[model samples]
Target: MSNNVVPAIINLDVKGPVISRHLYGHFAEHLGRCIYGGFYVGEDSDLPNEGGIRLDVVEALRALDIPNLRWPGGCFADEYHWMDGIGPKDERPAMVNTHWGNVEENNHFGTHEFMALCELLGADPYVSGNVGSGTVREMSDWVEYLTREGDSPMVRLRKANGREEPWRVPFWGLGNEAWGCGGNMTAQQYAAEARRFGTYCRDHGDNKLYRVAAGANSFDLAWTETLMKQLGELGCAYRPTGYMQALSVHYYTVSGPWRDKGDATVFGTDDYYRTMLQAARVDELLTGHSNVMDCYDPGKNVGLVLDEWGTWWNVEPGTNPGFLYQQNTLRDALVASLHFDVFHRHADRLVMANIAQTVNVLQAMILTDPDSGALVLTPTYHVFEMNKGHQDAASLRVDLPSGVPTREVESKELATVSVSASRKDGRVLVSLSNLDAGQAADVELDLRGGAVTGVSARILTAGELQTHNTPDAPDAVAPRAHDQVTATASGLRVHLPAHSFVTVEAALA
Candidate 1:
């Protein structure tokens, strides 16, 4: 298929706001490969590991520069007793993971191991505490253990466990999934619990904790508004350096209803358009949720942490359905790129967003084979690597013209591309993705009346729709560099292939 070339213009002067690093954050639940096989393979593996942390996965994530990681649980957070997983692996009591398959969860990867992994990757940690099944003292003591500077009860306990120095744990989640798996509480009930726990979650004075209240599952703006109204509003906390900072939101793109989520990669082009529609809604969700936040805090000091966002599908065959282990394809990569552009578009409001899991779980970056110890980087990882330019830079929004819209009997969707540009010191970077799958829509970039020079591009795509990586062939869907970018007097003309994802960067003359 040939892309219709159109005259485009891009302005170097008109830029948007700066990008936030939390937008590039990740998640790791204590389920499946995410803990045991995905990132932690034990220090004694023949496949090569550092103190049980997979070296290759660490290197790949470090390359993308993962900003923060949420750990220990999803639903598991609600049932978890932090003490059970801390002191010793063998002596630790055996507990069944009520959330993921009711599997026996050996407390091997505990507090120290998780903190050590964060240290290895040079990333921050967001610890999710239990509200449904734990007490306020339990939550506060956990905080004291990680953040206290001098000798205290929790600090002495930390020292007893071997880590004398305080770990810099900045983000703390009050709870996880309050409505359903967490505990079927109405907004009022959860607010009472939140106030009880959040009030006692005192600061230890060394590593400042930005406490995040357990969030509503999705785009229920009313829940957010009520959360602030019922509990002490986030920004109004007494200390300027707070124990409470932001509210979180979790949403997933599962097409064709919740039960039958079509196929992960076998969808038709129409399905691709529908999937992108749901994925692109992250932009709208942020706008709505932030509007609610602005009402309580006009300065917008309160942030929105999208702690969970990604594609969800039935588990891969032979894997436990409860585990959420699924495949990642080129189609998923396109969806991910679109989501990144959305985050950059709303950088000020969206403080952070973490995909469901980092590896071996839904929409993960890296996957590991249990028996063979083989690992593969997913298409989502490639999308993240390409967009690394926007990690910590300011976002600049350009005037984007309307493109052909994709309409269906069930869903109404638009296909126009959204792009965010940023300049750090001297170099200007623009990250863009084409959501149009049926046809390649040419974007006439207005280069602000300057002649273009020194252009380059990199793209990741595959010919077959179902193409992916496996134990034997891990590089089947890796990114390929593209040099087909062209510069013009008016602007630049870059071809975006149909049903493919690409990122372009250039030096202005």
Candidate 2:
């Protein structure tokens, strides 16, 4: 390892908010192969499946302890009509997916299929409702169909469709991207629409909804301010009469222009640093929104939900442009690590965050091959598995030295090292990332408030930043036991390899 060392302090005595497991949530949109071929294959297919859902896919995601899954759409949410997706699969209507690839959607994986998926993964479902072209009664009926019982019309329809009892759906999105893909409505227009739509999404006997309103588009404080003013209150122990429980925001780390996101597996050092710079900006995004939210709901009654995030790279070459299929690389894993560090810092108000699309989509954890029944866990998948220990753990403050190393790209300084710590059960897990492409970081963690007894680590890295897994070489970038950690009475020392993400699990005495 190089002589350069990064010093940081982990104050175990001062604990912050419990890192919500929902912070590790995932999204499964109906875009591209994300639904049909990625997560679902026909029940009659040769591959291992349970009720038309793929078993291999569920088995892989279960390792991450997936907390919650947002479904049905990104932009597709607005155009999705719940009625078309219920009852018999063959009888269900098919619509052209105008937001995604303009391809026909069979509505095969409707509410019941989604609920079955949640059960398979042991995750809660976050259903996003339509606000663009659907009626208020339609959204109300869909909620009732999924959660209500006791002789209602929706309950009758649900029973007719074969679900004898209602399923619990905790998270509900009123609308998605109302300013753009949802309906092209202004901030005021969407806020009014959200208030009206949120009204009828009633709670069932035992299933309470965490209603999330359509919030801003990346750092648009005006939109957030509008929602806060119209729907949120200045100070209240309880939610205002018509206030939504949470607000949703969207931000993607795209290295290039939106129309032409750079290649996923073909980026140089400069491109890597630029991408990290963009990912690091998520802190600013959260701070800006939090400030606006704090002004309206001082007690933090309204939660902030970063429901859509992750890298948005260009689709792999020779693929359908609208499918959003991309390769997940070591660079993508670093972006995820950096985002988690930021999420940990803002865990108090940030309730939940879901990566863009899960399998076979942009920055997906698992990529499935359509031709052959094969699966590959991306580098990002390993990161999630390694950091799963932090879920629902008490956050510890990581105080960094003033001279922490950084790389300047295009007049912007990107921190070369990132760290976050949390305590769960009797163990403390410290996640460290060395972002430098050429230099390894010798990190000295000052462990306070508890005596360190032992330390073990595992690392995920590749020979190149663009190195990724395919069906042929699935374990090319998987995590392996690392041996570069030492623990003493006062602290722990770790050698983090360049372009790598590591987790040091320590026993605190």
On TM-score, the leading prediction is 2
RMSD of 2: 1.3
lDDT by residue (tens digit), candidate 1, 1-509? 23544433356666556688889999999886688888887767786787788888889899999999998778899898889988867798989997888899888788898899899899999999999899999999998988887889999999998988898998899898888888888877887787788778876676777888777778788778877676344554422224458888999987778888877767787676677778877778888888877777766677889999899987887888878899998878877888887887778778888988899999999988887777788988988998887788766656655443344524465654555566554456666566655556455566674444566778777776567887777878887887656655567655666656767776655
> Per-residue error at 263 for model 1, in Å?
2.2
Q: Going through the candidates in order, what is the number of backbone clashes in each?
A: 23, 0
TM-score of each: 0.94, 0.98
The CA lDDT of each predicted structure is 0.78, 0.90
Q: Tell me the tens digit of each residue's lDDT in model 2 across 1-509.
A: 77769888888777889999999999999999999998899898899899889998999999999999999878999999988988888899899999788999999989999999999999999999999989999999999999998989999989998999899999999989999999999998998898899988898899989999988899899999898887645665435554378898999999899988899998899899999999999999999999988887878878899999999988999999999999999999999999999999999999999998899889899998888878899999999999999999999989986556888888988898999999988899999999999999989888878776667899999999999998888888999999988764568788988999999997778
Give per-residue lDDT, candidate 1, residue 264: 78
Please tell me which predicted candidate would have the highest lDDT against the true structure.
2
- 142, model 1: CA deviation in Å? 0.6
Which parts of model 1 are misplaced by more than 4 Å?
Answer: 1-11, 231-243, 402-411, 449-453
